[model samples]
Target chain A: MMTSPDSTGTVPVTALTGLSAFPLTPLKDGQLDQTAFIGLVQRLVAAGVDSITVLGSTGSYMYLDRAERERVIRLAVQHAAGIPVLAGVGAMRTEHVLAHIDDARAAGAAGVLLAPVGYQRLDDDEVFELFRAATGRSELPVVVYDNPSTTHFTFSNQLYGRIAQLPGIISIKIPGVPADPEKARAHVAAIRAVLPEHVGIGVSGDAFGAAGLIAGCDTWFTAVGGTIPVPMLGITRAVQAGEPAKAQALSEDLQPLWELIGQCGSLRVSAAIAERQGLAAPDCLPLPVQGLKPDQRAQLALMLDRLGLASL
Target chain B: MMTSPDSTGTVPVTALTGLSAFPLTPLKDGQLDQTAFIGLVQRLVAAGVDSITVLGSTGSYMYLDRAERERVIRLAVQHAAGIPVLAGVGAMRTEHVLAHIDDARAAGAAGVLLAPVGYQRLDDDEVFELFRAATGRSELPVVVYDNPSTTHFTFSNQLYGRIAQLPGIISIKIPGVPADPEKARAHVAAIRAVLPEHVGIGVSGDAFGAAGLIAGCDTWFTAVGGTIPVPMLGITRAVQAGEPAKAQALSEDLQPLWELIGQCGSLRVSAAIAERQGLAAPDCLPLPVQGLKPDQRAQLALMLDRLGLASL
Candidate 1:
């Protein structure tokens, strides 16, 4: 499945399962803090995350230019040591996305994640062709991102099936729907039935990762896990060991962070929490994107202490 | 006004006030066709376009990586042969954009054009900060882009006044609303009143460029004009020479190409038209975007013939 274009890097295409960290791409003085980034990736690998997804939602791939994105990917792959690295490759233009795929392969990533990000309203055919063309050219395996809120395009069951059949596509990241559990279950079940046996279903949304994991998703695509990885991994382990009650408790432990994330979105809340914990550098998102209001940070501090995550 | 970072490359920012070509960014097998791009830029300069926008919307600025965008800007500036070259300095991130400004300045560009291109809805404060940050860092003049259809954010009257006052911001690109004639006139007039006298208002929309010129707007931002520069220049010359009817007729000549662009978008239509005109190499916008179907190509050929623009 994940046939690395280079023979030197051989890892299973489905290696990115269980708990994966979409780490915060902390920047210092308007430039990437390479040491901080290397520390974050190495932390995830040491903590035993299934994969390190560099330039994920938490990593702010949209904010980075081509050179910065390539540098981030290379840093993640190099410091990951033996751990698998999945790079994010999303852009408004198809050729730009194709170029990112080529960059990911050249950087020796385990796989590249893609989203059909464009300003224009892309029809089903356009979105499908986007994936078809990207996967057609890429040597690295791809994880299709179905982020309707951001990309404004959902990978429908038919589209998912079509993408699943595309060569080098190994996974689909199904974003969480906290408001409708039944719909989420049905959606995942329908898509799972259509997807090939080898292809995996990853669950995004720190708020709904436990529910998704319980609903038979293969990976917990957590934003909080990227900073405070222990709780996320604890939930993953509980679920893997068939202890739903323990997983439920661990999932409950993340409710405070998830609630804050739900308030202002992960981009701000996660960075604020990381800054408070002293795990990440200041200003993850660009300026004018307020990290967290003073009151919100206070609540987050109290919650972190209560959950024994203040020292993480 | 366009103080190139390198002192050797001095050009007035207002020099880009006439017919300016936003050229097709030709790619051969997914790589930038340097020869074709250089030839296209050289052609525009030779034909006497007031400016050559290296990474305009037609050039697919959103699609190119930092290295490619840099290469394009550098190549255009070098081959511009002392003509002013306005470089597109837009990116989803602030630092990436700031980096692009440095790149454009280092590449010896006359000035840089910017747009609010973020993944999420950037608030008024954020947009202001984005410009303030960019202008504060660069020696080059700035052209604020207000393509709401593409950027999903309109530069309001307040915003126009605010950005117009920022240091190093010499111009603003006001996209013409030809469909709503009354709205277009009032919109431009309102912003013109607020803007500083030093800041020029350039008009985008090839179809409405003549009306914009008549209405006191400065530049004719043309996409089709990049490949067929003569007709666009003829309109500008007519407007400058105080012949409104001639300018109108010259603008009408672009109607057919604009109609095709209205159907499948500029990325498809421009590349197709450019490929047909032999102004660019085949396969400009990656695969599956398609270079005009046979019927569409036939229609385009007829339009080019009817306008007597076949040799342009």
Candidate 2:
């Protein structure tokens, strides 16, 4: 029900359809390999992804120095080539957020995804303040990101409702609660019902709940979309067009890879997948996160084979 | 009994005693306020702080652009004179850690305080690999910071024992455990018994634990020390010199301020106190973290007045 902010009464719910990949920014010999990054983006776009997120958690935004972030954003914006490039703009402080916004703006990003400030526990008012401050600084449309698993804080329904009223907020990316599908569905429905018709609510958890999200929200943010864009796009398109059987069937095909990834650690598994897809070099996870074990990798490959994504 | 690698004998067990203040890196508009930072360092040193840690969590090292981080490190090193300056060198990836070590070396930091590459959970081997890589990169002594509250993963005692064996790891700063006297004594005994004789164990939590840490560990890392240096330093010195009565008297004067901070939020309250003490600018916390409430501010002032530290 989220409507578009533009004059058009009809919400341009750009089928949050298709694969929305968060491509890993390649680092070679201790520096960002722009060539590898551009090649990766080109492949995603060619594979029929609808949108791409740059500088995501999977992209290791936390490690990138400021200049490197700027360069990465610029490259992503350039290679995205008219497909909306959503730049990640989360930082520990507001000044850094502002700086990132400036970089995103200069890179001509279509919109920015803002993560909550600080990794500490915060009340709703503080969360509102963070979004307000970020929206005030950013000229571009904003997409609020709610990924509680990494951030250690989740947005309450009331907080989401309040944020939906903000002028600059165009969309929200809600990560499906992994432990309970029913609660995730309820959350999506609640957010969708409360948000203005123009605001899009996208679900980010891959195909496991893609059908439910497509049914409840406006768009779906997919991790697999970054590498295997074609089939994901097919699934989303079918879901958006109300072809439930086709969508469900495709999700089944995609479910194996998702399950494989679920078995390993979060970002590490994602990075490993990216590496397998030739989008990145070896998975070079930072400390406190290691690559998957050989058996796990074999399981993942088997799943990839079943999904017809063996090339990845 | 953690003995030094060199013939320093039993690592001096210098009762990691005293108020170790981590002064904020001042900012003017958007840039590093070098003059203000230097002035603050001079004040802390003059106040008789036992040690100064620059580029700490309170110092906003993560938000600092690389050049800014270098500048801050250089400034802290130059201003530190003879005082030990522990440079914060935590990052998401090993490469970034290396970059931080290079900067720390260039700045002539006495030691590096490392936070585990956070935001993900790594197994034991990965943790070992991270420390091994870091130690290989730095020649200066290292202080391992085990702040599970921020890192989301606690360092196992076994891991600490392993890290203690690594070259260059001279100390550790562990927080969030109970701050009770008996508990503190037990923790020190346990860690000291396992760690090499050269490793120094430090305690970080509420200031009430400073005495306990002096009795238990080799050092005490205090957030309060950044604001009220004189009393904390006096208390640590008194405790170290086996003057329990004097230490108790100093603790009585300092206890109220610590309690007031406990009443308010930890980070905000500490930052507010630092601002009041003229160590940092008022209302300078990064986004999502607001300044103290008026009542909290008043209570802080009252505590400072009772301690006779308002003017100092």
Candidate 3:
């Protein structure tokens, strides 16, 4: 639920209070698999996920040229069928990110997600200005993504406090590196205490959804949830329904997949899972974004079957 | 000591058996410090450096736009005169790198240095294909840059074997992360053994230059040497003349500078050092590519004095 753009020209979003999915950008023969991508989004919508995010790390936003990125955002916003579609607007330069934000707003994106990604390592001031520059210009809600796994830059709690003061920031994706149950919950709760009541604090660890949900993560900023929506929903719902055992069991079932995802981070792993599960085309990703190796694919297949989600 | 490009498009040259300077790209009011950049090259040449490398990490190539990058390459090549000017051609896309290669060749660059710097995490095949796409088309000799600190992608010995088989590749810059003298030496020797006899193995640790020289580094690929070249020559000459005491003294003098460089990384530190040393304008760099903090700069100034390099 989006309340439209604010007076300051930023999108004012409804409180994101449930599971959200970030779908992989499927490709065919090095071209985006638009049909498969649309189908994947449809699945998430049918599963009643809160929102669908596009152009995340799994989307291979870095690998594609600017034209391709603009096209993806346009297509995602068009096909999302009124479900709020958040577009990742990260780039190497501040101007580049601003350009993407312009495209996102034009393409009717509900909001934009940003991660501090570039060639140079930024200090606190640089990183802050990066967010401010983008948020200050965009007419969409800004979700500050803190995925140090891919960006290789960590935003301390203190840094996040400073970032929260930016005018257009509607949400912050808390990093979930130490995704253990206790650690993950403690981390989420600590950040939740600091964020404004109106702003959302989402959990990024797909495997640790139960813990995060139990600990009051407003949204599950997730990868697997985007591809296979049912199980992610099950885990979140079980926790929300006050059934800790059910939530833990659903989370436990996702452990095997999480183990694979842990190796090279979520994007690479989620891209493979989506492709194998027929949610995306066979050649759904370009070079440098290869699927899981044969043995790993087999492991994934077996895990999916054991969890009764092979078909989904 | 460099030979011109061969008929086969491979850069040919005399063995690089001495120090090579890699100067930072100076900035003034968000513009290239043309006067300072040309002056930096003149100083390197005047100090009798064996070769010069432009657009390295110290050059902040990643932070600048393509137009800015092309200008730097053109300026460096024009001013380097007879000395070999190796241009960094790393970019997020293969086509972009390919375009830089063409510019490097057209600009009269003696060679091209490359790093695996796309946003995606590269496997062996992706890295190989990245090089092949670049080297397969470039007319200049290729120098493989293996700085995991910036790129976050390390080149293993096995991967280097595959990379070595490429035609235009004539040199490899061994990583200096674990900059311990013995470990660095052992690492360089291992790579050197794998490379063709004519193909040089260079060391990139600016602080550990004499140590690398003593350890059999044919080329001291350095950042500071590109600015204050005389001291680098002194250290290398001492090592070559079998004067370990003299070499050790020089290395010890550089230790303080290296300590500061190690804290944030050479790119940021070198950018500050070059600016403070009056090689570039004060406001050349925009956001993100900042100089060292106050205390670090003080430490650097003291170290430069103790090393008798303060005047430079």
Candidate 4:
């Protein structure tokens, strides 16, 4: 049902399923902390995430320059240790997206993720044409990143169906699913009905990832998992091992972090968690993206400790 | 109430009042069409616009790299001919925004526009910190650009009040006012009540420019005005000369254009108008941002002709 774009052994669409960790490209005084970033990558690889996606929203892709993005892409691939690396190649212009895609491919990325990073509020036609251009230009399998909170462009189911038909679109990273079980299943079903069988449904929004996976999403493109992949992998393995309750229980244990993420966004919360755990440099997020204040970080630390995750 | 940052004789806050036209940085084969951009600046000067703000949403600022943005800023200031060139200095990172401000100031721009450009859904504190950093880093008077339709970060009036207290914030560029005259007045008044007396209220969203002016907004930060300054000037001057009826009438004559703009975004419509009027290269907008289709262009041309705007 799916075809490889090249013989470089790029990660097949089937491999796109399961937990894909999105790491923070932590910064040190406005410069990429390469050692810290590599540590994050090695952590993901050691934890055995299904894929390593850099330059995602959690990765602060748009904040970095092209050279920095290329460095990230290259570093991610270099350290991934045979784990498939996907790069987020989104920019406001299609040309930049294509260039980023080329960078990803050159860096040996298994796939590239594209969000309709917009400043000019794009329409359906413009978005479709962007994917058409990217898929047409590169052989790397593409992942459609639908992040309305960040990109501010909502994709209708019809639009998703249209873009899914593009030659190399291997997955759609949806925002989230409903909290209620039946409703979540219906939501996933609505999207699944439109997508080709081989095209995977990867869910974002860390809080709802377990629900999404239990409802039939193939992957959890997660923010928290990028920093602490164990609990997330527990949920994913539980789901894969046909224990939905176990997966939900694993997810429920991290409810406080999810609540904090709901209060502060997932990016900042994840950064706080990483900094608290000594995984990244202090004050790791890129500016003007301030991480949690001292009090908030303390609260997060306490929550993590209570959840038995402070040592992670 | 306002003190000049220095004797650079930068455009004062008072001068920031009235129509500040936002011109498109039309591209030719993925590069800045410098000549076309200068022509746009010269046209605005000849039409006597109060200020020329380049690299706003219409200028595709986010799509451009640092060198390209610097070029645009330099060219705009060089060609604006004393019309108080204001450059939009918004980027996702505070450092980049500061860098852009430095570039704008070095390029001899009178002021810079700051939008809370976000990828992580920034909070009020983060947005405030960004403005604080920008204003603190440079003496360039800043305009708070609140175009949520593009930036996706809505500024609460309280946030406006907080940011306005910062030194060197000259104006607040609001998206639009309410349609009903009384409601529009009330809306503007509500914002005015929060802003410092030195900070002006500039309205964007071209269709509502006339009403915004009549409702006591100081400037119409417009897209269509950049392409066809005559009628926009007519409306602005009428408002300035205390002829609200005339301003409303002139705006009414362009209703069809506004309707089309509502259908196709103002950026694409403005690009089409520039191309139609032989002002810019064919298909002038940046890649992925397609210009109007042939049929849409034809309809636009007919409307321009019908409104006596064809030869401007």
- Using lDDT as the measure, which candidate wins? 4
Please give, for residues A1-312, the per-residue lDDT of candidate 2 as tens digits: 223332311122233434467777767656787887898789777876677888877666776767888888778877765667777888876777878988877777767788774544566787888788777875577888887766777787778889978877878888764435466667677777788877788777774546555456666676656655667677777877888678778877766666765666446666666667666676544444567878887777777776667664
For residues B1-312, could you state the per-residue lDDT of candidate 3 as single tens digits? 345453322243445557778888887776777888899888888888888888987777776667888888778767776777788888876667887888777777778899998566778887898898877885567888988877889888878878888877878887652457677678777877778776787778677677777777777888767777887888888888899679979778777777877786777666666777777766455554456778877877777777677687
lDDT of 2 by residue, B85-127 (tens): 7788877777778788888776766677887746555567877
Clashes of 4: 0
Candidates 1 and 4 compared: the better one by TM-score is 4
Tens digit of lDDT per residue, candidate 1, span B81-191?
887888898888776788898888788888888988767667787899889988998668888988876777867888899988998888888887554556667767888
Measured over the true interface residues after superposition, the C-alpha RMSD of each candidate is 2.8, 2.6, 2.4, 1.0
DockQ of 3: 0.41
Stretches > 4 Å off in candidate 4: A1-14, B1-14
For the predicted complex of model 1, DockQ is 0.30
Q: TM-score of model 2 relative to the true fold?
A: 0.88
Which regions of candidate 2 fall more than 4 Å away from where they truly are? Answer: A1-19, A117-126, A177-185, A211-215, A252-255, A284-290, B1-19, B28-30, B176-180, B243-256, B263-266
- Candidate 3 wrongly placed segments (more than 4 Å): A1-14, A31-36, A177-184, A241-244, A277-283, A305-308, B1-17, B31-35, B93-96, B118-120, B177-185, B240-244, B302-308
Per-candidate TM equals 0.84, 0.88, 0.88, 0.94
**Chain A (alone) TM-scores for all candidate structures:** 0.94, 0.87, 0.92, 0.96
Cα miss at A181, model 3 (Å)?
4.7
lDDT for B63 (candidate 4): 83
